[model samples]
Target: MLDLLLAAEEGAHAEPTAFFLEPYQWVSVAMVVLIAVFIWKKVPGMITGGLDSKIAAIRAQLDEAKALRAEAEALRNEYQAKIAGAEQDAQAMMDNARREADAILVKAEADSSAMVERRKKMAEDKIAAAEREAIADVRATAVMAATKASRKLIAEKHDAGADKALADEVIAGL
Candidate 1:
C-alpha cells in the first residue's frame, strides 16, 4: 500500500480497483441484481392487479349512481303530470258551477215576472165586478120611483066613466 501511494505521488497514473472492478462498474452490477430480484418476486404483476381491481370497483359505483339518477327523474315526471291533471279538474269544476248559477238566476227572473202578471189580472177582474154591481143598484132604484109616480097619476085622473073606458080599450087591443 505504501509503495502504491508513493508511485501515485510520483505522478504515476493507476486505475482505482475494488473487487477487481471500478466503483462505477460495481454500481451498475448492483442495479442489475436488484432488478432481477424484483422480477423473481413478481412485484410488477401484483401492483398492476391491484390497480385493475380498484378501477373495476370505481366503474361499478358509477353505474349504480347513474341508475339511481334515472329512477329519481322518472318519479319527478310522474308527479308533475298528476299536478297538471289536478289543475285542469279544478278549472272544469269552477266552470260548471258558474253555468249552474246563471241558469238558476234566469229561472228565478221568469218566475217573478209570471207572478206579477197574474196579480195584475186579478186586480182588473175585481174592478169589473164592482162596476156591474153599481149599475144593477141604479136600475132597481129608478124602477121603484116610476111605479110610485104612475100610481099617483092614475088615482088623480080615475072616475067610473074612465074605468069603463080603460077596460074597453084593453079588450079592443087584445
Candidate 2:
C-alpha cells in the first residue's frame, strides 16, 4: 500500500486503475445534469400556471357565492317588511271590527228599549178602550129602563093620538 501511494504521488501514473473509470459514466452524469437543469427551468412555469388557474377558479366560485348570499339577504328583508305590513293591516281590521260590533250592540239595545215602550203604550190603550165599553153599557141600560117606564105610563093614561095632540097644543098656548 505504501509503495502504491508513493508511486501514485510520483506523478508517473498515466491512467487511473479504480473501478469507476468507465467513459460512459461521465456522459450519463452530464446527461442527468442537463435534464435536471431543463426540468428546473420549465417545470416551475407549468406548476405556477396550474396554480394560477386553480386560484382563479376558486375566486370565481367565491364571487358567485357572495352574490347568491346577498340576494338571499335582500329577499329575507323583503319578506320581513311584508310580514310587518300584514300584521299592521290585520290589527287595523280587528280594531274596525270591534267598533262595528260595539255599534251593533248599541243599536240593538236602543231598539229593545223602543219595543218595550211601545208595548207599555199599547197596554194603556187597551185599558182605556175597556173603560169606554163599560160607560157605553151603562148608558144603554139607562135608555132601556126609561123606554119601558114611558110605555107603561102611556098605556095607563089610555089617551088617543088626536086627544094627545089637542092636549099638547092647549098646554103650549098656556
Candidate 3:
C-alpha cells in the first residue's frame, strides 16, 4: 500500500492528468458528448411527457385499486350480515314449517277418523236392511209352505162325495 502511494505521488509530479487527455483520448469524451446530443435531439419531449403521464396514471391506478379493495371489503361485510340474517330467517321458516306440518297431520287424522266412522255407520245400516229383507223372505216362505200343506189336505180332486162328507164333518166339529 505504501509502495502504490509513493508511485502515485511521483507520477503526479511528471505532468497534469487533464493534459494527458490528448486528442486521441478526447475521442472517448466526444463519444459521450455525441450520446448526450442524441438523447437531446432524437428523444422527443412528447415521449418523455407521455412517460411521465404514464407514471402518474400508474399511481392513479394504484390509488383506484386501493379504493376498490376498500369497497370490496365493505361489500363483503354487508353481504356477511345479510347472510347471517337470512340464516336466522331460514331457521324460523323451518320451525314454522314443522309446526304447520304437525297441525296438518293432526287435522288429517281427525278427518280420517270421522270418515271411517261415517263409513261404518253406512255399512251397519246396509247390513240391518239386508237382515230385515232376509227375515221377511223367510216368513213369506213359511206361510207359502203352510198354505200348500193345508190345501193338499183339504182337497179331493177325484172323490167329490167323500170330500163333501169330510167338509160336513169338519163343519159340525167346528
Best by lDDT: 1
Candidate 1's displacement at residue 139, Å, is 92
Could you estimate the TM-score for every candidate? Answer: 0.42, 0.35, 0.40
- Residues 3-100 of candidate 2: C-alpha lDDT, one tens digit per residue: 56887899675444446555677778889999898798897788899999999999999999999999999999999999999999999999999999
Candidate 2: where are CA atoms >4 Å away? Answer: 1-41, 93-174
Worst 10 residues of 2 by lDDT: 13-22
| lDDT on C-alpha atoms for all candidate structures | 0.93, 0.89, 0.89
lDDT of 3 by residue, 76-170 (tens): 99999999999999999999999999999999998998999999999999999999999999999999999998888767453789878989999
Q: On a 0 to 100 scale, what is the lDDT of residue 53 in model 1?
A: 100
Residue 161 lDDT in candidate 2:
83
Give the runs in model 1 whose Cα sits over 4 Å from its true position: 1-7, 10-16, 89-174
Instruction: State each candidate's clash count.
Output: 0, 0, 0
User: Alpha carbon lDDT of residue 31, candidate 2?
Assistant: 93
For 22-54, candidate 1 gives per-residue lDDT tens digits of 889999999999999889999899999999999
